[model samples]
Target: MNTVKELFRGNIRQYGMVIALLFIMVFFQILTDGILLKPLNITNLILQNSYILVLAIGMLLVIITGHIDLSVGSVAAFVGAISAILMVDMQMHFVPAMLISLLIGALVGAWQGFWVAYVRIPSFIVTLAGMLLFRGLTMIVLDGKSIAPFPKTFQKISSGFLPDAFGGKIHMLTIIIGIVLSLILVFSEWRKRSTQQKYGFEVGSGALFALKLAAMVAVLNIFTYVLATYEGIPNILILLFVLIVIYTFVMNRTIVGRHIYALGGNEKAAKLSGVKTQRITFWVFVNMGVLSALSGLIFAARLNSATPKAGVNFELDAIAACFIGGASASGGIGTVIGAIVGGLVMGVMNNGMSLVGLGIDWQQGIKGLVLLLAVGFDIYNKNKGVS
Candidate 1:
């Protein structure tokens, strides 16, 4: 019993969010008369939350560096407008247009990074300016108009999915993919444990490791099943998966990742220890810009058009998701998985409420309260040294 309690203590934030998610899901499942978990709605939940997950991942890194980004949403909108102009008005090819949009995002990041990192401006100020600047640029480019009917290839970025095939009754392809992914994840974990053991660090027990692998496999299988039941796995899902893996690895295993955490934990100490604070800050924003662009493209593809008002207030959702997911506002502490879970919780709440015919007013108020409680809990836990 003590051991189980210790496990929960060690993983309190994760478990907390997971418990909240389950509770909300169950409550809404009952409220909606069993419509909350319909395979189609479940799949849509994943699709709808994918962009938030993307922005959340990048936001995690930025927050880790003890900073915040208020411009990701505007940057996304700007990229979507550019892509629309290039594809629809200028009649550009899909690949080049996409590349240009990405480049524009990178440039926007670089611009903000320069002010925040090199010019010694506070991130809040720089990003506040960026929030306005990019929104203005988007309006200028789009001229308060909507662009539509992008090329088919571009539409596939979000709407396309793989066929359900591989073996027989099951979505063989999804199952196989899940199994392969599980293997890769387990192998990676094994390697990590081996490395820790070699370094004479406390490697978790063999049984613990096995249990972890089992949990991962179970999650993958369940997710694949849900997607298979709906319409197969989406291409955006694939992209989101790859980014998660890559970013997770970076945050967990790489030197740069360490630098980010170190900077977040204590900037003075990190700088004293020779962490390139400016460079890392610049790169973090650069990565944020790239992901924002990618998210913009996905959003456009999903809508089958780009509107002048795309991505309004999206930055708030991403920030709220990160904070609600156990990230410290002061920076230096957060997890990629935690951010994803937080985004999913918000997504599920929004979806369930909508399904139950809840009004926007009540929904907003409830969500705001939930966010406050979550962040307040984190602060309380930190003060109590609960973890």
Candidate 2:
């Protein structure tokens, strides 16, 4: 019992947000007459929120380093416009167009990073300027008009699904993939626990561990089942999975990740300890740029056009997701998974409210309130911890 209490107390913020997400889902599920979790809606939820989630992952790293980027939405729009020019006007293939767009994103990041990291400007100011600059550039690139009708192959980036290997009523491949993922999850957790025990680290009781594993496996299978019943897993989902695994590993297990946390925690101390604060900051922004460009591509693909307003207010959503996912305002704290969870919470609420016939005004207001509450909760926890 005491171990359980300790565990929960130590991870209250993470656990709390997760529980809140589940509660919100259930509440809406009940109110919407079970429309909240419909397979079709579920798929839409993932598709609509994918870009923001991608930005959140990159934003998490930025926030951890005690900085912010207000220009991601504009950057995304700029990239989308450029891609449209390449693919639609020049008649270039989607593959090369995407690669060029991503390269452009990296350059944009480098530009902002140079000012913020080397020039020693505040990130807020640098990115604010970038926000206006990029938005204007996007408009210029598209001639203040929307570009449309991208190649069909490019369209698949946002709308395509994995082909079913076995012909049946349901997608058998999705089910098999789910089972494989579940087994990997279980094995990884068990191995982690064993390692913890070997190192004299505290771990939950056997029964508690088993219960947690069972719950997780059940949820995984159920989610997969729903997708299987639909059109199976999306190609974008595979991309997201790969990104999550890579970033999670980078953040949790890499020296670069530790340096970022250290820099965020205290720039002076990190520099004194031989960490390249400026270089790290530069790279983080560069990373954000690439992700923002990727996000722009995805959005453009989904819309089948590159509009000037393509990424309006995306930075706000990504920022809100980081904070709501338990990222600290003072920095040096956050996780990739937490940011994704936070994005999902926002996504679910948006989808749910829409289903309930809420107006855009009310939806915006409610989301603002939720963001405030989430940040307030973080501050409260911090104050309590200090006390």
In candidate 1, position 310 carries an lDDT of 86
For residues 201-305, what per-residue lDDT tens digits would candidate 2 score against the true structure? 988899999998999999999999999999999988999999999999998899999999999999999999999999999999999999999999999999999
| Cα RMSD (angstroms) for every candidate in the order listed | 2.0, 1.1
- What's the TM-score of each model vs. the native? 0.94, 0.99
Model 2 alpha-carbon miss at residue 99, Å: 0.6
Alpha-carbon runs more than 4 Å astray in model 1: 165-170, 186-213
Full-model lDDT for every candidate: 0.87, 0.95
